[model samples]
Target: MISQVVIDKVLSKAQETASHSWEYGTVFEALLEYRDPHYSIFHDPFPGGKIPELTVEGVEALRYVKPFIQTNSARLCEGNGSSSDPTSLCIPALLLYNSTTSQAPDNPYLSAVNRQLHDLLSTTPRYSNGAISHRDAYPSLWADFVYMVPPALAYHGVFTSDIGMVKESVRQCQLYCEVLSTSKGYWRHIVNAEGTGSVKSDDGAWCTSNAWAAAGMARVLATLRKSQYGSETADEQKMLLNMTKGILDGAIEADTDASGLLRNYLDNETWFPEVAGTALMAATAFRMALLEPGTFGERYVGWATCKLESVSRYIDEETGVAAPVVNSLKEGQRTPLNGINPEGQAFVVLLYAAWRDRRTVAEDASVPMAGTDASRT
Candidate 1:
C-alpha cells in the first residue's frame, strides 16, 4: 500500500501538468513546459480529476469541455453527425457528473450531459452493427479506450438508478471482449469487429491496454455482483473469472523483460521510462491477486510488487515526473513522450487509492477474497 503523502505528491504533480495544458476538461497526451499540451477525447482525458483541481482548479477546465460535449451531443441527436464514437461524447459527460455528484444537487449541466450520453449510446447502431469499420480510430479498436468507457457509463447508471444504462454498459464490455480476444486467450492490441491481428506491431502487446481490460473487468464484475445479477448466476461469475484469467495469462506470456517489469512492446527490446502503462499493469494485477488469490495468485502478487518497486526507482523525486523510454528501432525511434499525462496519472492515483483501501481492509481482517489494500503491495 502507498501512503497518502505519496499519492498527494503524484496528484499534485499531475494537476500542475494538467493546469499548464489546454483546459478542455479532457486529458492530454503530454505536458511539456516548453510546448502546448496535446488534448484528445478518445485516449487522453483522465476519468477522475485530481482533488486540488476539483476544489481549486475552478471551472475553467470543466467550462472549456462543456461546450464540446453539448455541441457534439446536439449534433448526434439532430442526426447531422456520427455518434459512432460514443466515448468521445460519453466520457466527458461522465466526468462532469462525477465532479458535481458530491455537491450541487440537481446540477442541470451534469444531468443534461448524462442524458445526452445515454441517448446517443442507446440510439447508436454501430455498437451492435456487427461490422468492422474505422480501424484506425482509437475508439474503434484500441483496447484501453474500450476498457475505459464502460465503467463511467455503469457508474453513472448506478448513481442515477438507471438499470438500462447498467445493462448497456455490460453489453458494451462483452462486445469489446468478443471482438478483441484471440484464440490463444490473448487480446490483440489492434482490434476490429472482423477479427484481431496477431502480429506484434511497433507498439507490441501494450501493457496499458491489457491492464485496463483486467481492471475494467474486475470493476464490472463487482458492480454486477451488487446489482440484480448476483453470484447465483454461474455463467456471469464464470465470465468474470475467465476474463480475469485471460488477462493474467496474457500478461505472463507477454512479459518480455526478465526484470519482472512488463515491456511496452513484446517484440521490441527497447525500454521507455514512462510509468503509465507498466505501473497500471502492476497496480491492476496486484489488486486482482489480492481479490482472488487462486491459480496464478503468487505470480500476480510477486510480479506486481516487483514492478511497482522498479518503477518507483525511476521517478524523479524532485520533479515527480516519470521519464519516458525511447525506442532504438529505426521504425519506432522517436523522442519519448513526457510530462504528467492525465490519463496516465489517473491510473497512478487509482492504484495508490485502491492499494490504500485494500490495506485498511486487510488490517481489520474484514477483507473479502478479492479485497483491496491501500498499503504498499
Candidate 2:
C-alpha cells in the first residue's frame, strides 16, 4: 500500500501543476472519487466509502473543483465546438448537483448540468456509425475519449434515470472498441476515420490510451452495476468487462522486459518505460479484480501489485512526481521522456486507492462474519 505521506505529496503537486484542461479534470475526478471517498459515485467497497457529511478533504475538493465546473458549465452550454474533452466536467457538475441541499428544478447548477449534457448529446460531432468525434475539426476517434465522455454520460444516466443515456454510453464504447481494438487485444491510439481531419492517426498502441479505455470501461461497468439500472444492463456490463480484460491482459502480455512498467508504446520497446500508463493500468486491474474476484482476483491483483511497486520506484520522494511519461498533449507526435504531468500524478493516487481498497476488502473477507465459523479448518 502507498503511504499517506506520498499520497498527500502527489495530491499537492497535482494541484499545483494541473490546468483547467482535461488534465485538471482527471485530477479532479481522481480526488473526488478515490481520495475523498465522501464524493465518490461508485458504491462502497468498489471505489469509495459511504457518502457522509463533508470532511476536510471533501471540502477542499469542492473548493478546488467547484470553480472549474461553475465557470465551464456556463461556457460549454454555448455548444461552440466539437471538443469532447470538456464533457468530463459534466460528471463533476452532476456530482455537485447530487450533493447540493437545494435540488429544486430551478437550481442553476442543475440547469448547467442539463446544458452541458445537451451540448454533448446534440451538438457534438459524431460519425455515421454514431461514434463521437474526439476533435472539433473532423470525424476522429481517440482512445482518450473513452475516458472523457462515456463514463460521464453513464453517470448522468444514473442520476437522471435516463436509460437511453446509459445505452448510448454502451453504444459509444462498442463503436470505439470496434474502431480501435486490434486482434492483439491492444487498442490503437487514434484514428481519423473520415480521413478529412487534420489530426493524424496514431497506429501505435500507446500505453496511456489503452489505460484510459480500460479504466473508463471499468467506471462505466461500475456505474451500471451499482445503479438502479443494473439488472437491465447486465449484458452490457458483461461486454464491458470482457473488453476491459482484453485490453489489460494484452498490455500485460506485451511487457516483455518484465519491468512491470510498460513501454510508452506497448509494442515498441524503443520507447521509454512509462509510469503514468502503468499506474492507471494497475489501478484498473485492481478494480477488475474487485468486480470479478473469481475470474480476475488472483491474476489481476498480483500483477497490479507488481506494477504499483515498479511505479513507486519512479516517484521522487521530495516532489512526488512520477516521471518519464509521454507528453500527454503531444501523444500523436510520438514524443517520449517528458517531465511529469498532473494526470501522471493523479494516476499514482488512483493506483494506490485501488490497491488500498483491494487490501481492505481482502482483509474483511478473511475475517469471519457475524455468527460464522472463524476457523472451520
Candidate 3:
C-alpha cells in the first residue's frame, strides 16, 4: 500500500495540478474525476462535452445526458454524437452514480444509465459470438472497450441492488476474456470481431487499452465483493480467479523496465514507458491483491507499490504535476508525451484512491467486501 504521506502530499498535489494543466478536457475526463461534485459549481460554467451519441443499434447512448441548466454552459453530461457508442457510455453512468446517491434528489443521471444498460441487453453490436462492440468505427473487437463502459455499470449495479446489472458487467468481462484473450498468456489489442484481422497489428499490445481490460476484470471482482451478488457459482469463481491471475501474470512478464514501469506497447520494439497505463496496472493489481489469496495476492500488492514509485519521476516536487503522459497510440504511429493526458488524470487519481482505501479497509477487516476501498475523493 502507498503511504498516507504520499497520498496527502504527492497524489493530492498531482491531481490538483492536473485539473489546471490538462487540455482538450472532456466529460470523460470529469467522469474519472467525478468525486464530491459541488452541484452549485457543477451547475455553473465548466468545460465538458454536451453532445449525445448513438450506438450502432441507433440507441442514443447519451440519450439521458442532461444539462445542469440552472446555469448556462455547464453541460455536465455529454458524449460522442454517434449511434450507441460504448466509449460514451461511461460518462452517463458516472453522472447517474454521482447525482442519484447523494442528498441531492435522484437526477436524470440514474434513469439515463439504467436506460443505456437496458438497451445494451440486446443491442450494442456484439459479434456473432458475443463480445460487446468496442466502437462503431471499428469492425473488430477492441480490448479497450472493456474499460470504456463496464466498470461504470459494475458500480451502478452494486449501489442500486440491481443484480442483473452486476451480471451484465461480469458477463461483458468474461466475453472479453473468451474472445480476445489467450489462455495462460497475455491479451491482444484487437481481435477479429468478424474474424478477419491478422494476429498482430504494428501497434502491438497497447499498454493503456490492455490496462483498461485488466481494470474492468478487477472491477467485477471488486463489485461482487461489495454487493449481494451471492456466493459465486463454480464457474463465476473460476472466471474471476482466471481473470485476476492472467492479467497480473501477463503484466509482470511484460514490465521489462528498471523503474518497474510498463512500456507503452507491451510487445512493441521502442519500449517507451507511459504513466496512465502503468498507474492503471497498479490500481488493478493492488485492488486484486486484497481479494485473492496467498503469495499470488501478496505479489500484486508489492508490484503495485513499486510501479507507483516508478511514476514518481513524472510528478514534480515544486508543482506536483504529472507529465509526459502519451496523448494517444496508433497502429503504426506513436504519440509523443504531449500535454497532461486526461487518461493520466483519471488513472493516477484512481490509483491513489485505491491505495488509500486499502489502508482503511485493512484496519477494519470487518468492513464488508461490497464497500469500495477506492473513492473518487
Candidate 4:
C-alpha cells in the first residue's frame, strides 16, 4: 500500500492549484478526486457481503470535493446555459451529495440535477450513430469524453433505478469503441466524422487519452455490477471488461521508454515519457484486476505494480506534483520538467486509491476457498 502522507500531499497540491491548471479545470479535477471517496465507499468486491469504511484519505477527499459540489450545484441551479463540454463530469459528485444529504422539497439542486440530465439526454450534440460530441459546434469524438460523460450517466442511472440511463451509458461506450478503438489494441485520440470547420482530429494513440477511456469504462462496469441490473446485463459487463483490457494491453505494450513509463503518444518515440498517463493507466489496470480477478489478476497486477513504482519516482518528494507529464491544455506539447501538472497529481491519487483497494481484496482472498477444510487446521 502507498503511504498516506504521499497521497495527502498529491491531493492537497492538486486542490490548491489554479482552477485552469488542469485542462477542464475544477470540474475534471473534482470529479477525479471525488472518485477516491466514492470508490472506497461504494465499490464492494463482494456484492452481498460487508464493505469496509472509507480510509482516512478517502474522508479527506470527500471534504476536499464537497465545496466544489456545493458551488457547482448552486451554479447549475441558477440556470446556467446548457452544458456542451465535459462539465457533466462533475454531475456525479453533485448527485452523490444530494442523495446523501437532507434537503427541502424545493431544493434547488433538484432542479440542477434534473437540468443536467435533460441537457445530456436531449440537448447534447451527437454523431448520427449516437456518440455524444465533445464540442458543441461539430460532431466529433474525444477519448476524454468517455471519462467525462458515461460514468455520470451510469451513476445517475443506478442512483435513480433508471435502467435506461445505464443502457445509454453502455451504448455510448460501444459507439466510441466503434469509432475510436481498433481490436489491434489502441484507441485514436480524436475523430470528427462530419461538419468540416476548425475541427481537428488526432490519429495518434495518445497515452493519456487511452487511459481516460479505460478508467471510464472500469467505473461504468463497477457501477453496473453494483446496480439492480447486474445480473440482467452480464453480457454488456463482459463487453466492457474486454474493452478495458484491450486498452490496457496496448498501453502496457507501448512502454518503450527505458524508464518504464508510457510516452505522451504511445507509438511516437519522439514524444517524452509521461507520468500522468502512466499513473492513470496503472490505476485502470488495478481496477481491472479488482473487477475481474480471473482474467487480469496476475497479468495486470505485475505490470501495474511495476509501472506504479516507476510513477512514484516521478512525483516530487516535497510538492507531490508528478512531473514529466504532457501539458493537458496543449496535448501536443510537453510540460516543462519543473512545472506542476494538476491532472498528473490527481491521477497519482487515483493510482494509490486503486492500489489500496486491490491490495485489500488480495489480502482478503488469502483465506480458505469456499469448499476448503483449511480452516480446521
Candidate 5:
C-alpha cells in the first residue's frame, strides 16, 4: 500500500503542475516544455492572433484542472485551434466540473453542450451497424480518447440526476465494448463502426486500448450500480455483470505481463514491458471492482493491487511521478516510455481514494467480511 505521505506528495505535485497550465482562463493542451504555455481565450491581447479563447466547456475543464495549470499560465492558449470539438473538450470540462465545489448551474450553454454530446452518441452508428459507419471516427480509434469520455459523461449524468443521460452513457459503453471485443475474449486495439478489427502495424495488441475498455466498463458499471435507475431491472443488472465479466476476462487474458504488470502490447508472440497507461488502466479496473464487490470483484481487486504495486515500484520518487521502466523484447528491448499524464495521475488519485474508502469501511466494520474478502485478497 502507498503511504499517506507519498500520496500527499504526488497529489501536491500533480496539483502544482496542473496550476502552471492555466492562463487567460484556460488550461493548455499539455505542459511539455516544447509546447507554448502562455495562451488563453480570455486574454489573447493580440488582435487577429492565431490562438483562440477556451470554449465554455474549456472554462468548465479549468475548474478541476486549475491546480495543475496555475503555474503554467503562459501556455494555456498556445496550441488550441479556434474550433474545438465538443467531444474533445468534454473531458477537461467534466474533470473540472467533478473537482469543483460549486454546483453545476442550469445554464443553457452547458445544457446545449450536454445535449450535443448526447446527440453525438445517439447518432453515431453502432459497430453492429457497419464497419464503415459513423462510429468508426477519429476518437473511437484512439483508446485514450475513447476511454476518457464515458466517466465524464457518467459523472455528468449522476450530477444532473438524469436517468436518460445515465442510460445513454451505458449504451455508449456497450457500443464501445461490442466494437472492441475480439473473438478470443480479447479487445482489438482498433475497431470499426461495423465491429471489424484492425491490427497494429507492428502486429501487436494495444494494451492500453484493452485497458481502457476494461477500465471504462468497470467505471460505467460502478456508476450504473449506484443509480436508482440501475436497480429497476434484473436484465439491466445481468447485462452489466456479464459485460463486466467479459472485460475482466479479456484484460486478464490479453494484457498481463510476466512482471505482474499489464503490458502495453501483446500477441502471444512476445511480452512488452508495462506502460504507465496500461498500469493505470488495470488499476482503474481493479479500483472499480473494489467499488462494486461481487463474484469477480475479488479477482479484479487482487489483479489491480498487484499491478499497481509493481508499477509503482518504478515511480521516480524525486519527481513524484511514475515512468515506464519495462520494454518488450518484440520491440527489440527498447527502454520504456515515460511521462506524467493527467489521466494517469487522475487514475492514481482514484485508486488511492478507492483504497482509502475501503480501508475506512473495513475498519468501521460497516462492510461485511465476505464483501471485503470478495473485493480484496
Candidate 6:
C-alpha cells in the first residue's frame, strides 16, 4: 500500500533541502538556507578537498531519484567522485554505471575515479582486523567513518568484479561492532584506533554519529545482493546480518517511551529524540526489512515507520527544512528547532527513498528488484 504520490511528495521536500549541496558545484559548499549558525566552518571553501561524508549521502540521493541521468560513464564517475572515500557516496552512484565504465575502461575519467577507489583500499591506514583509522587530523578510529568509508570499499569489490572487497567490508563491520557496540549491543560514538590508545571503551554512543553506521550497513547489504559473488554464501555477510539485528534490537529496547523516537545517548538519561539518528535508524529498519523480510525486516519496517512519524514533527511544511539536527558530536549542541545541517537534509531524502523502495517491494511483490529497473530515471 505504498503510494507513489506520497513518495513523490516526500522526495520533493527532501531534495529541496539537499539540492544546495550540488547547487554550488562542489561537495563542500552548503546552500544559504540550510546553513547552521553554530559552525563557522561550513562556509569555508575547499578547492579540491574532500567532504567524503556529505558526498556519500548526496551521491545516494542522486542514485535514488536520478537513475536516468547517467548516460555517460566518464561524466557520471566524475560527478560522483567528490574527493573519494571508499564509503564515499560516490561509490554507489559511480558503480551504478559499471556497465558503462566497462564499455570505456580507457576513458581517463573512468580511469581516474577507478584509480582513486583502488588507491584508497591499497593505501588507507588500518588497524588490526581492517577497521580504518579515522584520525586524519589526529589518531583515532571514528565509529562514524567505519560505516562511511569501508562499505564503499566492500561494494567496490563487487563493482569491479572482485569478491575480496565484500569480505573486507564485512571484516570492517565486525571490527566496528567489536569496537563501537555496548555489551548489550547498541552503538557508541567513538573508539580509539588500535595504535591510538589502550582504552577499549567507546567515548560515548552519540545517537546520530552511530546512525551513520546503521545507514552504512543498510546500504552495504543492498549492494551485496547485486553482486555475482554469491553474497549470501559469504561468512562475512552472515556476521553482518547478525550484528545489524543486534544493533536494532538494542535500539528498540532503549526506546524509553516506546514512541519510535530514540534518545540521544543510549547510556544517558537525556529524554530528547535526535532527528537525524531517528531517520537513519528508520531507514536502516526499512532497508533491512527489504533485505530479509522474515528475519526481522517486518519488525524493522514497523519501527522505521513509527520513528519517521515522530521525526516528521521537526521538519517544516513550507520550507522543507528539518530543524534541531545536531551537526556533529563535537560542534553541534542539541538545540531543538535550531538551524539545519546538509547531512540532516540528506537523511530526510534517504529516509523517504529507503522506506519507499522497501515498501514498494513489500506491497507489490512482483515489482522489479531495486537495481534492475531499465527505465528507473
Q: Which candidate leads the pack in TM-score?
A: 2
How high is the CA lDDT of each candidate model? 0.49, 0.75, 0.54, 0.69, 0.46, 0.53
How much does candidate 2 score in TM-score? 0.89
Cα lDDT tens digits, model 2, 1-377, are 46779888987888888774567668876786566653455444123322233423345565667666653354332223445677777766655565545355765666776776676667667876789888776778889889888888887776667899988898899999999999889899988866574657888999999999999888898878777777999889888988998899899899876556888899787777888999999989988777766557566767788898898888888878777777887764456545667888889988888887766756785743211233221
The TM-scores, one per candidate, come to 0.67, 0.89, 0.69, 0.84, 0.65, 0.70
* TM-score quality measure for candidate 4: 0.84
Q: How many clashes show up in model 6? A: 6
Clashes of each: 18, 0, 11, 0, 30, 6
Judging by lDDT, tell me the better candidate of 5 and 6: 6
Report the lDDT tens digits of candidate 3 across residue range 1-377.
43434434544443334321111122233333233222111121122321122231222212212222111111222323212343334444444345323214544444555555555544456766666665443344667666655665665665565777767777877877777676535577776544444544322567777777887676566556544554643466467668757866888788887655687777764766777778887877766655553434446776777887877666655544455566653433465465545456557766776565454565675643322333211
Error of 1 at 13 (Å): 2.6
Name the runs in model 2 displaced over 4 angstroms: 45-58, 71-82, 101-106, 332-338, 366-377
Candidate 3 Cα errors over 4 Å, as ranges: 1-107, 137-139, 156-162, 195-203, 232-234, 329-332, 362-377
Candidate 1 is scored at a TM of 0.67
List clashing residue pairs in candidate 4. none
Residue range with the least summed lDDT across 10 consecutive positions in model 4: 368-377
Per-residue CA lDDT of model 5 for 243-279, tens digit only, reads 6566566667665466666665654535456644455
Consecutive 10-residue window with the lowest summed lDDT within model 6 = 37-46
Question: Candidate 2: lDDT of 343?
Answer: 88
Q: Which candidate, 2 or 6, has the higher lDDT?
A: 2
- Report the backbone clash tally of model 5: 30
